[model samples]
Target: MKRRNLLIAVILLGAAVIFYRAFGTPDQLATGAAMVNVTVPELSETANEGEAAFNRLCASCHGRNAAGQDGVAPPLIHKIYEPGHHGDASFLLAARNGVRAHHWPFGNMPPVEGITDPEIAEIVVYVRELQRANGIY
Candidate 1:
């Protein structure tokens, strides 16, 4: 009888663990809910050229304000891409060479074609300004 009870308890504990992993913890659920909705503020054109370049090149996937398209790409306004975490050089590298998607489930980011280094710099400036305005900095 004691052995049967212990087995039942272990099975119950295992089921609970599996359920949590599949459904996620409360905090994970909350975070997911939060990410589902995001507010993108109006961009202050600190770098007009950059803004133009971003609109011409990156707006489709990243959104006009860099708020990011759901399932397509992650938002740049998020803290994950803050300057401390992903610097200006990271943007250049991403433009020059495709980046492996490590942060989001959107898969790999293909390298942008036909954009000059100077243009990329300008886009970086624009993105950084947006990040700052949105308090991601």
Candidate 2:
């Protein structure tokens, strides 16, 4: 009987491992935790202004420092957005004209309103600076 019980315990442990692997461990299942802290690098005066503009105009979807928000927008600091792939003009065009959904699951990006070309330039500066700081450049 003791041997049978030990066998049963082993089977149960195996099942638990399988379950954890399939559904993730307890910590991985915790989605309600506070937002993870992300360190944003300091910027030059122009880039700082751009940061403020980004926080006001872009952070809702792009997330602070353009780190990106899941199901909202793709991160600007990612390798896919390297200048060679997505040049500075791409950002301007995206803000001026909404972009079709292609890379990410987050639907199409709508043209930004209430911001001008100069402001967009500032935002680009801020984004590029952040990207550089994070080694995305």
Candidate maximizing lDDT: 2
Candidate 2 structure quality by residue, lDDT tens digits, 1-137: 99999999999999999987667656654332223234568888889889888988888888777877755687887878889899999999999998998877567999998878888899999988877877777
Worst 10 residues of 2 by lDDT: 29-38
Per-prediction count of colliding residue pairs? 0, 0
TM-score of 1: 0.68
Q: What TM-score does candidate 2 get on C-alpha atoms?
A: 0.71
lDDT of 1 by residue, 64-96 (tens): 667777556777778998999999999999989
> Please, what's the RMSD in Å of model 2?
8.6
> Which candidate achieves the best TM-score against the true structure?
2
Query: What would the TM-scores of all predictions be?
Result: 0.68, 0.71
lDDT of each: 0.78, 0.80
Candidate 1 CA-lDDT value: 0.78
